[model samples]
Target: MKKTGLFYGVNTKKTAQIGKQIQEAFGTDQVDIVPIEEAWKTDFEHYDNLIVGASTWFDGELPTYWDELIPELVSLDLSGKKVAIFGLGDQAGYPDNFVDGVGILADAFELAGATLVGFTSTEGYDFNKSRAVRNNQFLGLVLDLENQSDLTAKRIAAWVKQLKKEWAE
Candidate 1:
């Protein structure tokens, strides 16, 4: 069986949704969701395959908790671990080169010694610019990439499946 892990940007229903999909895809409890803020940061290397996500803030920075958590992750040894990344972002309307918190999380993951499998963006579904987002509702700018509604979860689930396929080799 594949030992899977999930980390979220912050505390939100979106993170919970991401957790549910991980549980389902990995077969009931085969997966674990750790808030990058709450996790020990160093526990990531304990798993074989790691999937992580982040919700974007106005400046495209990781949430406060995730911000403090990066250094810990950067200190781990993940040399050959399978990794997948997902992020929540909205269009900056500038040059379209923005992808929310994607880059922030990717950089940390790479520095931590893991090799990323791939990535995707929800694209154009930004909520940080309005009160609607402050109200804690969801905008579909991003997708689950799976049948679920959370793009982060969908991406993680897909990544886990891909790792399984790779391991069989």
Candidate 2:
């Protein structure tokens, strides 16, 4: 009943909050959100489940930091690793750019030999949903890795229950 590893690819403040929420909700004391810019090969190996997040720049353009980090990521052999990708963007401003960064992570994670867990999608809450998401705005949709530790924690708690159910079968 111990949650093992989780990693993030963003250096933004949101990443820390999301990481903390995951740790608290899943009851996993061992959780670290490493910035992709400062990531090392050893970082990839130590994690069982990796949660990667990044922000869109230049009106949905890819941030160089995450892009630069990607080349290094594919070199790792994440055979048994599970991946969850989240992206930050303004869907209203850059509708076309929504969730594009996700594919990059998914493709690279696949190349590095990892399986995606839960769901994989982008979450541009700031502009997409007016900074206030009602109901399950992005839960099974864009895959919200959002603020709101209380709500986020609750959703993750349910996901954990579902996760165990899936594994049990």
- Candidate number of the best TM-score: 1
How much is the lDDT of residue 120 in candidate 1? 33
Regions of model 1 farther than 4 Å from truth: 92-97, 120-160, 167-169
Q: Report the Cα lDDT for candidate 1.
A: 0.58
Give the per-residue lDDT of model 2 (tens digit) for 41-143: 8888887666666555654445677777778889889997766555554455555555456556667888999876555222424343322122433322133
- CA error at residue 35 for candidate 1, angstroms: 3.0
lDDT of 1 by residue, 97-149 (tens): 23345566666777877776643333335433422121232211234222334
- Residues forming the 10-long window of minimal summed lDDT in candidate 1: 131-140
Quote the lDDT for 94 in model 1.
17
